[model samples]
Target: MSAPTPQPTALTLHQASRVLEVGFDDGAVFRIPFELMRVYSPSAEVQGHGPGQETLQTGKRDVGISQIELVGHYAVQPSFTDGHDTGLFTWGLLYKLGSEQAELWSRYEQRLAEAGVTRDTPMPAKTGGACASH
Candidate 1:
């Protein structure tokens, strides 16, 4: 039989540290940064409609979470200070983000370099079918 996915045992929001601390029943704890969460949001607004259509997030070094609303029993929806609140972070997603932070950060930096921009660079105005206002 397949093993059941780990469920969250605790969740804490550290506003000052700008991280969400999540503990799982499987004895794993993750402190996911707000900036990282915003940059890697799974929303269509950030992820776009398909592969190669991701909207690179920049100038989010200080992004903050204003609120986090629990969704049913499976996820949490965070409202960012930048006005982004569409991404529903499932337990699995959060766990992945926490476990892969180092690699994700390296990839983010590489993408920034490839785009000829730095992390501090302000994001350009978004324009497209799904994101016409940003």
Candidate 2:
């Protein structure tokens, strides 16, 4: 039989530290930063509809999770302080983010450098797109 999916045993939000701490039944614990979550949100708004369409998030170093709601039994939807509330962070995605934190940071930094922007640079005004509110 196929192995069952890993499940989270505990989930805690440290608002002050801006981190999401997740503990799995397998004894794996990950402390994922809120900034990272915002930058790498799994929503279409950020990921876009296809490859090469991803919107690089900027000035998100201070982003915070305003609220988080459980989605059924497999994920949690977080509402970010920057008015982004569309990404549904699944257990698998969360685990991956936590485990690959360093690599992800490196990639994000590289992308920023390529775009001639810095982590502190504010994103330019969003042009017409799926959501006018962004």
The segments of candidate 2 whose C-alpha lies over 4 angstroms from its true place after superposition are 1-3, 130-134
Runs in model 1 deviating more than 4 A are: 131-134
The CA lDDT of each predicted structure is: 0.92, 0.93
Candidate 1 global CA lDDT score: 0.92
Worst 10 residues of 2 by lDDT: 125-134
Model 1 misses residue 8 by how many Å?
A: 0.8
Best candidate according to TM-score: 2
lDDT of 1 by residue, 16-98 (tens): 99999999999999999999999999998889878999999999998999999999998999999999999999988998898
Alpha-carbon lDDT of model 2 = 0.93
Clashes of each: 0, 0
Model 1: residue 92 alpha-carbon error in angstroms: 0.5
Clashing pairs in 2: none
